[model samples]
Target: MTVTGHVKTAPETTAQVLSAEQRHADELAFLAAYDDGARPPGWALTPRAVVTFIRGSDGEPLTLPAERRTGTLPATMTVAAKFVGERSLVERCVVTLAGERGLLLVGEPGTAKSMLSELLAAAVCGTSALTVQGTAGTTEDAFRYGWNYALLLAQGPTPQALVDSPVLTAMRSGRVVRIEEVTRCLPEVQDALVSLLSDRRMNVPELAGTEEGLIRAVPGFTVIATANLRDRGVSEMSSALKRRFNFETIHPIADADTETDLVRRQATAAVERAGAAYTVDDAVLDALVTVFRDLRSGRSDEGWDVERPGTVMSTAEAVQVAVSLGLSAAYLADGDALDLMPGHLLGVVHKDDQNDRARLLGYWDGPVRRRAEDGSAMWRRLWDLRESLR
Candidate 1:
């Protein structure tokens, strides 16, 4: 039988981003041997180990306890934190997955819902590739199964003619399947999951007489789906569909320092991928993240009422802006990355509403000017560059 799933490609040095499994192969292997706790049926790592894989060992070296040691694994290893969020939230997600329930992560765009999903899947099942990208054009066949048309035409609906969807493959193999932007799919197409999730099995009507027609999920089969708050009304999910999944709201990083650090690290990684040195000053990054937070929260850190932009000023967007500044500093010219902030901020603010331009200017007039008045040199430079917003 043919499977319709992520096509395996030979590793490319220039691959912009590697799968969670590919990028953290060593860590996953280490965690497996490090933890001897009982794993759910068909899981690759214990629930605790899975959480550790995502949250890191908090910079401490994890020494495999005396009894669980195998000569194959290193005696001690350090796992870097991958996701930046509450450990309790990660624990809750792990618990849901261990119970084999559908997990629905709802959040604003770029809150790392998808990243969390990938990490959980990779840690649990050793792969984050069984995926269905939900879009308005997505059809039911994308969730169920398709046919190898050439084979189907030559030999009727035999088992060999079946092309398993990612969801079907996950069911047969007892792995986690991810559906991104689940709400973007048409309601009818989204309903296709209700029976599969509720029954934990799928029936192939074309091959009804054959034993292969009925495919039941083995243990460890579950799903992790994501939805953007911005797309909530585009295709509302039926109450039946919502009932099948445990909903978790993923929020933006609450602490300014944590968010700034994450932006610096991510932007540096991105610039390095392009073979450029990241030279954007930490001051510039802090300012950039400050603007995003102000616009995102609709209030300045100092309790000033700033006009919020209609567009989402997310942390992910802050990283992009920082990367742009870094790239400009590295490749284009010898100037402070701060010089380009206004233009980038303008670009981001103009995404959804034209009036947001005025909102951004209001932000500059309010917080930026006040910070400049308070003798902050970085804010002073940003204030001088205010004409760029026009």
Candidate 2:
């Protein structure tokens, strides 16, 4: 079958990445039956269930009431946490959506802002495909509507010729639409959403006097947008647009141990997906996380001052570094994963500024050397490998 002008293909079994909805289809279905409480219109799961879906069930199995049990779903299930943040934050996001208000998640790069948006959309609407990836060239058509030139010319400005943008489609269907990196879009293009959100209706002047001309949003329709804090000055959001949405700041994982575990879990999954055993040692992983946290926060675990890199040393980047280390350990038989750290770290630090290399070297001279002096064998090895930074 075709959607728009393109043929829709069957699900690729070997897809490298799956959307939140596809990855957690079973949990969604189970949660739908698991929660019989009131749900906002067009929502697949109740508000509470939506929260539970994103922030797992804390290892406790939830039993489906016998009356609601079905053959496809198990009797009892333990929901797995997909987004690693506070349950209260997820609850606030759900509440915002439930009220049908526009939600804007603002955060530093790689803070799982997009991941949280996808998870919430999937839990609420049963699909996370209605999305617009904002960029410098994005235009009003992306947030409002577009046209099929062929259909427009052949049939005139009719309903069939009008192509629905993701936001428009979401409005009509009463589902959630996600705008990723909203700040990347030009200021004028970003304004398209202000009126749309405020009015909850879009006037298609091209189709004026027709039944489909004025498109009104149905119940449960909402918008979820994400903006990276690093992109604040790129295209600052207008006050009007900001007022239409409830803003939530997604912070990086606060606890070092939690961040380390997340990095390990995500990196291991990444390596295994590449068909390799993730054999990176725990000690190496701990040291790697320590380096990332120290650089990102500009302070060492021991409270020693360290220079921050120009490039954001995000957890997501740390996971990639861990994945690289794991792959090197798995494939490169002669090399230790610990020995490969300096080069990968150098690559991350050197992204935006070459001067960051000096900062990285300084970190080694301070934290790594001090830890080595404190008799940590792992830190000692890392210290010995400082020449790798050059």
Candidate 3:
């Protein structure tokens, strides 16, 4: 649900939609009886089902749905999700949670770090609402507690005046807490976690005399933090702090077909949301994907050399481009949605810093333009529009 538009996720059948993880409540309880650690009541699945939920049952075998009704997960249980490649990275995340360790998801922008964190939290705890958006302005109070200003003025800072941070709430309730863009916080501000992770407790010394001092993390409690590799001035996590968590680095999509599937699926859904009929054909979508894939990897389909722009060529941006073109065609153009071509792409490639514009031009000089130079009419039209990029 990015930006509150017509964008939607893969529509799931009614059965696939776990209206509330409540459906899995019994199954999770069954697994918990044998679970080595104390269980978090109301959890959808034991840590195991939670793992299966995220790793997805793509290649795994399962019994039929009817025979294994009670205490059994679905046989056709597959999440029509879109995180590409690196099943091991996904596995590592689930494994880390099963160990009750904090999981820090690290990845390049657009590699789905935020999405994976969201999915992982949803699968593990069945809710993704407990999240903290980190910024340089983020304070230690964000990780622990703050005073409710009105109450504090009236009651003079009593325990009841305390307002809990999302992290504090998750710690107390034994749910997964997410700290998004973890690196955006200042180093001193980020250091506030040293005690939270090590002690597994938060102390509100302000209310020490009245017995509201410490909040303890119950069983099944954990934290999932996200950091984008592209952010500069990210506060380096201390080794001591890092030791308390397991780290999983998500890599970009490694397959063309898979990446293409992602573009087509996600983009089409986005276009339908814009109150305009979708008219961009598969050929246009494939061309957009191909351009992005080549620009991102610095290589063409024929194994030809091309220089990559010094920018983060993230898929999220690509999705936006497809959606943008869709909107442009839907609102302005009639019938000829595919005509957007290089003109639409100009808006995207130019935003990638100055050198990137040059790189895009360099890309144009080669395959992109060469195709225009050659007899391919598609490339010729795109080359004709190159002047608009300047």
**Which one wins on lDDT?**
1
Error of 1 at 272 (Å): 0.8
For candidate 3, write residues 81-195 as lDDT tens digits. Answer: 3356576777778778877788998988888888788777776777777889998789988988888899999988787889989998888788888999888888787778877
Candidates by lDDT, descending order: 1, 2, 3
Candidate 2 wrongly placed segments (more than 4 Å): 1-12
Candidate 3 regions with alpha-carbon error over 4 angstroms: 1-43, 59-78, 373-375
lDDT of 2 by residue, 163-275 (tens): 99999999999999999999999999999998889899999999999999999999989999999987445689999999999999998888989989999999988876766
Stretches off by above 4 angstroms in model 1 are 1-14, 66-72
Lowest summed lDDT across 10 adjacent residues in model 1 is found at 1-10
Q: Which whole-number lDDT from 0 to 100 does residue 358 have in model 1?
A: 93
Better of 2 and 3 by lDDT: 2
Each candidate structure's count of clashing pairs: 0, 0, 1
| Alpha carbon deviation, residue 363, candidate 1 (Å) | 0.5
lDDT of 1: 0.91
